[model samples]
Target: MADVTHASNAPPAHLAAGTPPILELVNIAKYFPGVIANENVSLNVFPGEIHALLGENGAGKSTLMNVVTGLYQPDAGEIIIDGYGTTFPAPDAAIAAGIGMVHQHFRLVPRFTVAENLHLGWSETPRRLSGKDIEERASALSKKFGLPITPSAVVSSLSAGEQQRVEILRVLSRGARLLILDEPTAVLSPVEVGELFSALRRFRSEGGAVVIISHKLDEIMALADRVSVLRQGRLVGTHQTCDVTPDSLVTEMIGRPVTLATSYPRQSPAPAGGEAEPLSLKQVTVRDAAGVVRLDDVSLALRPGEVLGIAGVTGNGQPELAEVLTGLKAAESGTVYLNGKAANRADPAMFAHAGVGHVPEDRLKRALMPGLSVAENMALREYDRPPIGGRFSFSMAQARKFAQMLADRAGVKLPGTQVQIRGLSGGNQQRLVLEREIRIASHVLVASYPSRGLDIGAISAMRDMLARARDAGVAVVLMSEDLDEIFALSDRIAVLYAGRLMGVMDRADADRESIGALMSGRNLSEAA
Candidate 1:
C-alpha cells in the first residue's frame, strides 16, 4: 500500500526528448505455483499512443498485464509511472495511478441505462444527481471520444460494439490515463472494429495511452504504434509497428516460420445432384419465450459428403437453429427430415435415435459432465444401448475400453480412464466430445463453435476430425462466428441475419468484405 506516485531521479538514456512515459515496467517478473508466468519483461507506454502486446495463449501477456494492474505483484521489477517509482497492492491502487483495464467481457448491468451504469461507482457524484445531468455528461464524453451512444439507451439494447464503448467510457470517466483492453476485437464484426478504431484514435489524439493485448496481427499493424511480443513467459522483442511484417511477428512469437493459414485446402464440390438429402429443415419457424421470432421460416438442405457452414455474429438465431436441429427445441412450424424420413420435432430423443449428433456451443453446460470420469463422460451418448453396455445393465469395463479406443482415434491425450474430466484441459474435453459425436453420427453432424477457445494444435485436430467426417459421407453443419473457420472447412456458406437466412454462397465466392456486410445485417444479395 505504498504511495504509487513518484518522480524519477533521471530519465532513461534510451528515451528521446519527449514527455516522460505515462507507465513503464522494467524487468517485471511474476510466478505462480509451478509456473513462470512472466520473466524479465520490460514495457513502456507513452502518452498518446497505441501499444500492442502480442503473444499466443499462455505467453504471459495476461500475466504481465495483471502485474501492471496490481492484480498480481511482480517478484522482481520496477514500475514507474510518469517518472515515479510505485507499488500497487491492488487494483484500486492501479486506478489511483490513472491505469484501468477493460476485459473482454463488459461489466455493465443490462437492466441499467448507459448513464446509470457509468455513474454506478463514482464517489464524487452528488447524492441527488439527476438522470438528465448524468445523461448529458455521458453524452458529451462519448461524443468527444468519437463513440456516439445515447446515454439514456439501455445497456441490453446496445450492440456488442456499443457495449465495449460504454466500458471504455466508464474507465475514462474515472480519469484513466492509460487504457488496457484484452482481445478487444475477438467478438466484433469488421464494421464494429472500424468504429472501435475511430474511438481509439480519438482517445489517443486527446493524450491518452492504450495497451491492447490481442492475437490479431492485422489489427496490430492497423492500430498499434509499437508492438511487443512474448513467448513462453519471456520477452522476445519489441519493435515499431511499421518496421515489422506479420511473418516476422509470428516468428518472434512462436520461434519459427509460420504461414498463419486459417483454412485448409479447398475441396472439389461433390456431384450429388440426384442424391437424397441427409438432413433437411423445410420452412421451420421458431419462437423464444418472449414471443420473439428466433428463426423465421428457415429452410436448409444438407447432402451427404458435404460441409455446410453457417456464418453470423453471435445471437443471430444460430443457437435457435442448432437447438431445432438437435431436438432440444421444437420448431413451432414446418417439417424436419432426417435421412429422408420425417422426424418429430417435439421429441428430444428423436434426433439421437435417428443417428444425428450434436456438439453444442457451450461444452460445459450442454455436453460435458465435469465431475464424472473421462470414460464415463465419453459414454454419455450410448451407455444404455450400445455394445459397451446392455439394455438392463451398464458395463464400466467395456465403457473404459471403448472410451480409450475412441480417445486414441480422436487424438485426445488422457492421464487415465479413471481421471475426472474436469481436470482435463479445454482442448482435450472438446476432443472427447468430437470423438463421440462424430462416431455416433450416421447421416448428419451439427458442430457449433467447434474450435472456439481452443489452441492451435486443438484447432488443427478438430478441423481434421470434421474433414474426416465429411470424407466419410456424413453431412456436416458447422455453425461458427469465426469466419476463418467457416471459410476453411465449409463447402458452402450460409449467412444469417436477424433470424433469417440472408443467402447462401459457395465457399469460393465468399470474401471477408461481403461476409462482413452480411453479418452486419446487409442481405447477401444486396451485398453482392
Candidate 2:
C-alpha cells in the first residue's frame, strides 16, 4: 500500500496560533487480556470543530473513545482539558468536566417521560425539582438546540429520530462542551440525518467541539472538518478533510488499495418455465407477544436467480419479515409459500430441510454459538446429516475438513477451524455464517444486514458472495438499512414502512428518493 501518513504526528494547525484544544489525549494505550486495543494514540479536539474518527471495526476507535469518556481508565496516557491535565474516575466525572457521549443505542429509559429521563442522572440539581419544573427545563434546552420534543411524552412513544434528539439534548442539558457521537446516523432517515448535521454545525458555530465516529465515507467528507484514521490500534494519520479523497481514507483505514463493489450489472432471472416461485408471501400478518402488529398484510414473491432487496429504516418490521420468511416466527394470519406449498407453520429445521437458508440479523444470538469452535458452529445445520455426522453418530474429522473447505472458499482468515468462533474478526465470522448458509441454500436464501459492521474489503467480498448466489439460481432476499447496498444489489426493490408493504418495483424504476420516501411511510404514488 502507498504511504498516506503525511501528518501522522503533527498537532492541529490551530495549536501553533496559540489556541488550546478543548480535549486532548497524549500517548494513550489500552489493553485487553491478549489484545492491544490502542497504542500510543494521540489526538486533539479543538473548539468549534467537527473531528471525525475513522477506522475499520476493531481498529481501536471505540477503545480510544471509551478512555476519553471514562468508560475505561487507560493503561497509559495523559488527558488534558483546555490546558489542565485531569483524570476522570467515572462517566459522571467526565460529564462534570464538560464531556458527554451519545452511543449508537440510545440510553433513555423507555417507560420514563422525556423530562424524567433528562433529570435521571443529573447530579448538578441542588434540589428535587417538580415534574413541571423538569419539563420546563427540558423544553428550554430543546428550543435552544433547535431540537423539538414533547417533554411529557414517554420515550417509547417517540420515533427513533425523536429518541435520538432526546439523547443529544440530555448531553447538552448536562452542560457538555465537547460531545462525542458513535454511529449517530446508522439508523436515521436521510431527512433526520440532515437535521442532525445541521444541529452539529450549529453546535460547532457556537464554539462547541464534536467528535463523530462513523464508517460512511460520504458522511465523513460532508460533515467533518478534520479526519483521523486508525489502523490496528495505531494512528494512521490526521488530515484536513480537503487534503484527502475518500479512496485515500479507505486505503489508510484498511492498509490496502481496495476497489469497492458499488454495483453489479443488471441480470435477468432465469425463466420459471411454469415452475412455482421459490418463495412467496400471501397477505402475511404477524403480531408480537404484546399483541402489537409487527407485520401487517405484507405480500411478496422471490424468483430464482434474482435478488429482492427489502429496504427500510430500522424497527419497521424488517426483523419480523425476515423471521416469517425463514419460519422462525409464525404469522398470525396469511401464508408463507415455499415452492407454492404453504409453510407458514413450519419451524426453522423444516425450512432448512426445504432448502431455505437464513443468515439472521443477530449473528451471535441466532446463528452462531460463540463458545463453540469454528468447525462445530459450521456443523450446526448439518450435524445430523452425512459427512458431518449421523442421527446417533458424530464425526469431528469430517466436520473440520468440511469447515476448512468452506473457510478457504469463502476467503475467511483464521488460525484454524479448531479455534473458537468468537476469537475471529467480525468480517471472518460473517463470512463463516455466509458460507454455511449459502452451501445449504439450494432454493432460497434470506440474508439480513450481511455486511452491517464489516470493513470495506469484507463488504466487497460479501456483496460478491450474495451476487454469486443469486446468479447460481438461488432466490435471495436481502434485508438492509443501507440504501446504497440495496440499489447496488437488487434486481427488484420492496419498501416497508411501519410493518406494511409500501410497494414493490423493479430496480430500474427505483431511486434513493422514492425508496427513502417510502421508508418514511409515504405511499408509492406520493413517493413518485
Evaluated with lDDT, which candidate comes out highest? 2
Tens-place lDDT per residue, model 1, 1-528, is: 011111121222333556678988888998765567799877678888788888766677877887899988999999999898999999989988899998755688999999998888787567887889999888888776667788999998888788998998888878899999987876676788998898888888888899998866778899988788888788777777776898888877778765535665535455457888877899999998879999998999988888899998888899899888878888889888877878745665778877789999778768988789988988888887767777798989988998899889887755578778765556678888999999778888999988765545467678988988887778899998878889888989998889998888888898988988888798867787
TM-score, one value per model: 0.77, 0.81
Off by over 4 Å in 2: 1-16, 125-133, 265-276, 286-296, 312-317, 346-355, 360-442, 497-528
Candidate 2 C-alpha lDDT tens digits along 17-89:
5566888889999887667789988878888888999887768887788899999899998999988999998
Query: Candidate 1, TM-score vs. the true structure?
Result: 0.77
Off by over 4 Å in 1: 1-18, 128-137, 260-278, 288-292, 312-316, 338-445, 448-462, 480-485, 505-528
Task: Score residue 366 of candidate 1 by CA lDDT.
Answer: 86
Error of 1 at 162 (Å): 1.7
Highest TM-score: give the candidate number: 2
Give candidate 1's whole-model lDDT.
Answer: 0.81
lDDT agreement with native, every candidate:
0.81, 0.86
